[model samples]
Target: MEIRPMRSWIHHRRGEVLRQGGVGRSAMPGVYEDMLTRHGFEGRDAYLYRRHESTAWKRAEGAGIHLDLDGRLLEPTDLTDAGGNPLRLFYNPDGAVSVSRRSANMTYSARNADGDELYFVHKGTGTFYTEFGPIPYEPGDYVLLPKGVTYRIRPTGPDNYFMIIETTEELGFADIGPHGRRAPFDPGLLYVPSPELDDLGDGRNQDGEWPVRVKYQGGFTTAYYDFDPIDAIGWSGDLFPFKLNIRDFRPITSDRIHIMPSGHAVFATSTVVVGNYLPRPLESAPDAEPFPPIHRNMDYDEFLFTHAGTALGVPMPPASFALTPRGLHHGLPAKVEEELRKGIKPGTVADFEFIFVDWAHSLVATPEALAQKRAGDQLREGVAAQ
Candidate 1:
């Protein structure tokens, strides 16, 4: 009888990285082809390609749509000044993506019975008045209002910016699995709004009535109340509005490999998954780089919002968004990869803070977003003028 410890050998052949390290060359033919075909890169000339330094996809024909905007410039004041309502960037039957700006307090509360509201405060200080209480929010807070929750925003100043993810399914923390009870942070640390009864002109107008608007079945219906919509004296529930600061998120990292996108997931619904990418230690492996691998996500449509990050010597300004549909090859630009190959010291902190969402089903881009896309010569001219 023979009992032996097996050693796994990682191997490379013909410019492809393979996992059967200890296998002899005579045993590689079938295994190599199977691996390539399974990954959808099969070809007689199939080889690894890097997208780490190339931004040419922004102009590529037939590429999945991507959007990058000066999110910081997309303030509510600017939208109102430009005579536009909150702008929708992408949408589908399941959900929608948009940005909203508010300069003053809202007079009426809003309740969306169709879906949950996930608000990322890109800029502004404000109080989110809800049935549970007055929840104070500021930049970087992720404020979640579950379906049917009445709420309104009141900014302390004249400017507020928010990115809204309206998911048809309710949003909640992703299952952390073996990571821990709170892989990111404990639920007790979540900022549950302290309930406060509002004093709205003695609880009512001369007519002794207040108003709350419910958005459902496609349109709004106004509901009259004897007191303000936020006049809940007290409440308790596992399902209530709360805020989680992105700064408080502790991203899972790896010492020797690039952490998979799933490792960064913070919020999830049956159809949508949102990841918070904060500054963290980069992959320390000798061959692995501090960027995403070139591949496709066949199961989900993916997007990234660059709240902050520096990549390949370029500072990815906050508020930029990018979308890549399933089966598309996307990753770091070529220039960024080139810089990484030259070597960045191990343990250097990655200067990136962003959010990524993967929609399990396809998402449709709005015509307005398509119309706004500039490429090729037009894109060049615009950059030159800038």
Candidate 2:
């Protein structure tokens, strides 16, 4: 049997650094500041100041930061598939992120037998007609649906956008921790719809022999219903779909240092945890760097949807998405890094809002997802400047 070495959490530092923590401290000249940490900035860590620094390494796999494929450019199945489904973009064993461009009501009620589904309303005002009740959703609202629940979205506006996340396990609100249950967003603020008692809808989904689309094990099975599926007179249970809007989210901030991304965790399944990166103040200490340090997410893959606003004045277009694998260094765009190196301006606030998933499994961007890169570039090739 092989034996493992004992590990210690003691602090050890050498070469050009006179101290341990980099907070309010600057490294010596000609030193490349890079940190290697375990458990996403937690656990034992090391700050290495190397003599050489370069990103000129060549060739293959997750090559560049892809911010070109706008979410609106891709065509979802709701526009093409006869049954009306979203377009699968990035997926893994644990979860998947798909984009939906829906402007009309779904003809068939859909049920996911595979996993719990959640939709981030990027752009739309719609009512999610579920078996329980009708939950009206707006932009920045997250519509949470339990697995095997019957539901269909009916948009009341044009250019409706949705980014769907489906996971194998049920997702619950992340722990409130030291702040308690009411700090981030009170459980009371969650709008759990009551079943429509008097009237579900006037002649809606009344098409003869209405179909219920059931997605199971990568294939779909349709079950025909003799009447409308939203015929629930009453519902009494703890397990039901609900909505949590971004407006209710209270962020954790610190002017001393740029807090870790985990501080913004909102929802989590057994295998994945979702983080909401909302607009907030940046670090303000005189000697402290105001941006995330150059580090690798060693344990989980990072996938993000840039929803809106300027990311610290860095021009990441709204609705653009990007994926940084587990081992690759996180991208610090040139313009943003320059401001970081100089330390952020005092009392500066970043208005950028994004939805990111720190999934435990390595993700694979689907072929149709990859094809969007080519299609996007071609579409933008001859467009006139605004």
Candidate 3:
């Protein structure tokens, strides 16, 4: 890890106390609060009190990309052909995010030689037939398949949607800190399959080649076998594929302050951090914002898939998702900010829910995503409606 410089200083303001006489407070009357933070809101921060919206801009022409995509419209190749795989959405050296709309059972098994894979079930029920065993999946579940582990997914239903984050690094559970794992989720809630050999059969076409496709460095290598290769009847190991549903997550909340996103991290690797933006009690402090702080995260890029609910006045359709590149100021949509500007009562609830993944480095979107990109701003969702 690169050493970040540390220094000692006192925070002094140049402007008058618009209202709360403090830093990082959200919209109050005509004033706006914008924050610049390091370490994903866990480190040093500078809150800017402005007379205007922090997310406002005259125009963003090039690299100032803030993307909002409608995943409900994406047509992944896997939806039609069994030989097809997830359609690449965004990628960088560390990882890639893809979407799969597969409606059929796989004709062959596959393995990722590059890294571990995470499949966030946006919709549908299915079973992951892996070498370890079979793990059934449903909407709102996160299925993790370790690198080099052979697996294939078979949908139990016809309509299915999945948001997948496949990375080139090892994946593990996030530390629950002093609260222990029971706080966010109980490890016991994880559905880990043991190696069991039952109903295991040859490929759909038993008389044909049963191919084991291995994906490495964005290329596939097929090894055909006359007989099925998933022959493990018993195995003993801590390493295996598992599933965790979002409904079981208990996100920490505070009525006094808006907790940072990192506080919601359920999974992390050296290169990525995955979190659930579940509904929780909003801040009730008389002087604080009820929503997340308006922030320009200096380090990581954020990717969010809205499973349900309207967020920041943005009515989320099925499979709604957004991307806020690192350094881009983001938070509530402008329309919601305006509502906050008016005033909010005590004990408000944050009803919005989504699954967010943060990459330590930047992500490059695929051509498919670029073709239908929507120009977004903090207010665009609301502004466009007008």
State which candidate has the highest lDDT: 3
Candidate 2 lowest-lDDT run of ten: 377-386
Ranking by TM-score: 3, 2, 1
- Model 3: residues with Cα > 4 Å off, grouped in runs: 1-29, 200-207, 312-314, 333-335, 338-348, 375-379, 382-386
The C-alpha stretches of model 2 lying farther than 4 A from their native spots are 1-9, 18-22, 54-68, 80-82, 197-207, 333-335, 340-343, 374-386
* Cα-based TM-score, every candidate: 0.78, 0.87, 0.89
Candidate 3 vs. true structure, TM-score = 0.89
The Cα local distance difference test for each model comes to: 0.63, 0.70, 0.75
Instruction: For residues 1-386, write the lDDT of model 1, one tens digit per residue.
Output: 01112332433466544443212212333222111112111112222433232234454555454444455544333345322235677777778887878766665667888788899888789888788888899988899999998887767887777888888877878764477876677776789887886674422334666667786765678788866767678887778899999888887877666665767778888668787778887665664545543455566677777766665344555676667676544554334454554656777776677777778777777665555443333211111000
Report the C-alpha lDDT of model 3 over 18-103, residue by residue, as the tens digit: 34333235435566667787766555777777777766766666765788777877888889987678898899898889999988
Q: Where is the poorest 10-residue window by lDDT in model 3?
A: 377-386
1-386: candidate 2 lDDT, tens digit per residue: 01112345677666566354546435455555556665554446677666654222343354433223566578887865435689899887777889988767777888999898999998989788888988999999999999988987878865788899998888887662578768777889999988874443422344555788899887899888777877897889799999999989988887776677767888887568787888787777766666654566676667778778765565656776666666644445334465545545777777878888877787888877776553333111211000
- Model 3 / residue 288 / CA error / Å: 3.0
The regions of model 1 sitting more than 4 angstroms off are: 1-16, 19-63, 70-85, 200-209, 371-386
RMSD of each: 8.0, 5.5, 3.4
Q: Which candidate comes out best when scored by TM-score? A: 3
